[model samples]
Target: MKYKKTILATTILSALLILIALGVSLVVSPMVERKAEQLLTRYAARVGAIERCSFSRVEFSPLSRSLTLHDVLVIYRSPKGLRKSMDRLEISVPLRAAACAVPSLRPYVLPENGSMDVCNSITADGVSFSMPGLLAGSLKHAAISGVSADARHVRAILDGRRPEPVDLLEHAVIDGLDAVNLRATVQTGTGSAACTLGAFRLRGLHDLGIEEIRFEQLNAATNKERAGIALFGMDGFRAPDAATLRLLLSVRLDGKKSPQALDKDIEHVLPMLQQWLTATIPPVRVLAVEKASFRGSRPQDVMSLDLMRLDWLSNRPREMKTAVKDLVLPAQLVESNGLHLPGLKELRFNGESDTRDEDGRIRETGYLSLARFGQLRYNASYAVPGGVFNFSLMQLLSMTIHDAAFSFVDQGALAYIALNQHDPDMAGPYFNQALDYSFPGRDNDALRAALKVFTDRPGTLDIVKTTSEPTPLLRCFDVATLGRLWRVSATPGKESLYDQMRRLAPAR
Candidate 1:
């Protein structure tokens, strides 16, 4: 009877001890969780200026010093209003250095801990950011790891959104370009903000990378609106450097898609975004923006424009033009659409085109430059009053000559030859063999009435000081040719010079 009583007492004592231990553990866990969340919120608010950070479930193990949170929602104040959400966040602190968990990385103080496990987030389901009514960006199944506790540096594998292009033109069409496996690192200091993006490929485009992008700062606030930097802009541009900016970067995104639908509100607001930003944001300047393997209306009609990449600089509205006024090019631009431009050098644009209106007032003056092709260098301009390519220059033989010749000639040689009953003109039999042309009324000169357009000696122009008036296209010829049928029409005393030539020609 004594042995039975002792055994029973011992059993009851053991059970009571176990229950007490469990009660204590359960009671302390909530306190630890609260402390961990408070620390997280305090540090995060310092780094990102987080307004509110809420998590549905917070778990902490005091013994192990490990913390985890689920369904995290973070709000930040900057360029307009910004919001970020993540699925799970986990942080581990070594027991030896719990005090140094936040900032002042004493990685050396704790040799075992070279870097503090400040943040290890897993958006296993998805991640998202938004600006109230304006726009939203999303990425799925990404683990953005290794964020410094100080929040000055971080890396992410972002397979997600690039800024949606603002196409104000109605009935606008677009191509698909979704990125994948984008490995990017962002680091910011007092002077500038820099990013390195690589190992990324745009669907149907080349593998792209950004070697360097150093921005002056991301201006999140300018006092005009209670918004963030997205509202203000970046230092992507500087007015003093409108002519040129010394920067280097490489990125490509060419997607092929048919315009499936259009949201009228989105279309309207998209362009306003650029305009509204121009009024506030700092200029985000870049050295270049190039595209390759871009398809257009027809799949086979791959856009192989010589200066498409640089056109973005010159084509933007005047206020936004200075942002990237001079877009430099790489040595070679390539794409998957069987289109390639090798040995391309630079685009020295003046941000204007010569396309004139019906009144003949000089309109936009665009595309004037000294660019290289193969071993040859050339200058091309679409500066004509009507935006037609009025001039082209390159090497012809040894001398640097320009065949400023493009013809929609009038009363073509055949019609004139037939009208004259095969009468020999200034060109004689060669005139019959010359180009058959038409469009006779553009020229009003009576002396050279047979040929509406004539050639000239290609001379260079000062792009800055060049005249801005609607002018006729010059059809220049190799001046050194003894039997050259082309004449310099604009020369002083050109009529007299032509008269002598007419007298020497075989009688009509």
Candidate 2:
């Protein structure tokens, strides 16, 4: 009998505890809702000193610790004195993050660790925005999903100007941004251009690895004609640094910073530009663009690129290489120049450059290859004993051009010469006949004969020039000086042009 009585007493106590917990939740829910609304209202007002902000509902869910805002509207004036509007915006975020957005609430909710993991993610939907003035357009039904940020980093970025904000990005650790439906229009010298982006996504804020970003369409018009790009996209993009963002936020962003105003503010403008240019380029393992297509103002004018890739191999000598594949030029553009070819096909360019070597020499090499025609390769070497960055006038004058080479490897272009020679038995092709007739016979015999060796045969032709002595940089200003400085040699070869140049002795 005593055991039964003890059990009954414990059950009643447990029931009472449950009732008390329920009462507390019921009592606190309304207070939390009202507080959230008040904080958000203040935030809207403070954001960019907005002209106005309104919303239909402020919903807070205590169970999930999330806040949802509906039917929001914001109006603001841009730095250019243009008015902008965003309407029908819906936003959802964790309550803690929402609280952090409110300046007054920040102190109360800040984490002890200095890294406030605001939320797993935040989302906004049904966003529409418009900008008015010379550059004006509207974005329709845009959405942002899976955005997350560190509250402390946010504070650092929002609290200051310029370099501080950019520097803080290193520790910001924002990630997982997916945004879509970006559209814009801007005034151009001739007419206006309009562009639309299908999507943009990023993995992190500080490191800024772009997963995928693509522009769906671009339409540009001028007084004379219209052109457009069907599509352009990039994936796995890594920015070298935040300097680009810093420059955009600096004084250059103002609409008043036009060329005329820039000219007046030359002292200020030049230094900023120079600083940006000299900023270090981080070593990117590989950067690639898959494809790009452009349609010119005319229907027949189209250009397309298959692939482009860049690789940064080293930093000491700052070595890098770039290559393009299957680039096609417009047929109409070639025809306009009276070239009797459909177009240049499979045009490719590959280039490499490396900075100061052991002897303080810089070398650059490149080649242009055409599938139907041939390849044109060039090489240049320079000696800068003072160092690459030693740009003093004396250092520049001390620099010397060592040697240079230009070679053309014939794949099919040589056949045209024979076809151009008139035949009594048959009427030659129009392009070949016209080309032969139009080319003036102004060259001296030796020069013409030297060129004829390559024109007559299907092989590589090398034109290598070696300096009699290392030519000073300033001597390049005068053509006669270069002629006197360089001893030119032309020959047919199976070996590469640079190889031949290296083996050949300078003409006495």
Q: For model 1, how does the per-residue alpha-carbon lDDT over 34-95 read when each residue is reduced to its tens digit?
A: 87788767666665456878889898766556577889898876655778786866655555
Residue 165: error of model 2 in Å?
Answer: 7.0
TM-score of each: 0.29, 0.60
Error of 2 at 58 (Å): 3.2
* Residue 59 Cα positional deviation in candidate 2, in Å, after optimal superposition: 3.1
Clash totals, every prediction: 31, 0
As a whole number from 0 to 100, the lDDT of residue 29 in candidate 2 is: 60
- Tens-digit lDDT string for candidate 2 (90-167): 455566766766678878876634545555555666555555546765555554444544555666544542336665
lDDT minimum window of 10 residues, candidate 2:
499-508
Model 1 weakest 10-residue run by lDDT: 242-251
